[model samples]
Target: MAEALDQARAGRDAAGTALVAETRAVVAAAGAMSARFRSGGRLLAFGRNGGAADAAHVAVEFTHPVIVGKRALPALSLGEDPSTLPILGRPRDIVLGIRPAPDDLAVAREHGMLTVALTMGRRRPEADHVLPALSEDPLIAREIHVTMYHLLWELVHLFLEGETEA
Candidate 1:
């Protein structure tokens, strides 16, 4: 039991370290996403298997913000079929792929959409922004990804609020 606890603690520490290292990138991504939203662009997220759930969660967070009075942004989850990205995607859209295929991101880029990839450090997909997982364990990686996306959602709102105030 103690051994399991130690491993969990280590994973949490690793995730925090990785997030701290990528703080700049995360802020940049949120800024970019905010720009897209300001331009009337929608967020289109996609993933497969377990990642599909993550994608859906992202979409919900953006479309139905838990915070009261927060504006609901346009967002959608493509589920397992990213092939439709080429069809559903628009030039000003933001494509968020959670452990998605490289080809899917490439298509989004080709369509002039901004692409973001949440990777497990195994495969690097070409994207405007890439958030790589630090822990080798899948569970830890998922936890990191969840935290990253939550931060992104919050920061994007912050940028939008700043723009409105300005």
Candidate 2:
């Protein structure tokens, strides 16, 4: 029982520290994303299997903000549809790859879309922004991702309103 608590504490501490270190970058990314949104760009988030699930969560949260008085932003999930982005993507739009499959970032880059990749130490040069999960354990990675996306949602809104450090 104590071991579980220790592990949880360690995971949380590591995630918190990593996120703090990346706070400036996160805000910067959010600022750019907000600019795109203000210019009529939509956010396209996609992933496969577990990534797909995170994409769904991000889509709904961004499209239907739970916070009172927050504006609902335009966002959609690509799911498993390979044709979705090619059909609807614009240069001003943004793409987020949650544990994306091979070629995902390449495709988004080719379309000239702003690409944000949530990955675990995998260098993604095709992406404009790369946020690391910072954990090797799958469970820890999942928890960190949940926190990261939630922060992304909140920070995006804050950035849009000029209430953040962006």
Candidate 3:
């Protein structure tokens, strides 16, 4: 029990550190995402293996908000095959990649879409914004990614509502 508790505490500490390190980038990305959505843009998320699940999760969160009264936004998960991105993506769309292929991000950038990458390793993919998980454990890294995306969703809504009032 002590071992489990220690591991959990370590994971929490790592998550907090990673989030703090990337706070500025996350805020900037959320602002950009809000702008894109305000301009009638959709969010296209893609990943492979475990990342595919994350992509779908992100899409559902935006398209089907669990919180009542919150606006639903357009979002789609491309799953493992990102080849369709070129066909489905639009200039105003936001592309979210979780450990995605570099070429896919490049294509999204070329098409004038906003690109955000969630990575967990030494190699960082090119994107408008990159959030890298600090933990070496895959499970912990995934937790960090999940938290980061949730933050993005929440902040995007905050920015969107704020802009509406302004």
Give the winner by TM-score: 1
What does each candidate score in C-alpha RMSD? 2.0, 2.4, 2.3
Q: Which candidate leads in lDDT? A: 1
lDDT of 3 by residue, 5-42 (tens): 99889877977786798898889889999999999999
User: Please, what is the whole-model Cα lDDT of each candidate in the order they appear?
Assistant: 0.89, 0.79, 0.87
TM-score of 1: 0.93
Worst 10 residues of 3 by lDDT: 157-166
Q: In order, how many clashes per candidate?
A: 0, 0, 0
State the lDDT of candidate 1 residue by residue for 107-152, as single tens digits.
8998999999888866788999998877777788898899999999
Ranking by TM-score: 1, 3, 2
Candidate 2 versus truth, CA RMSD in Å, comes to 2.4
Off by over 4 Å in 3: 1-12, 164-166
Output the TM-score of candidate 2: 0.86
Candidates' TM-scores? 0.93, 0.86, 0.90
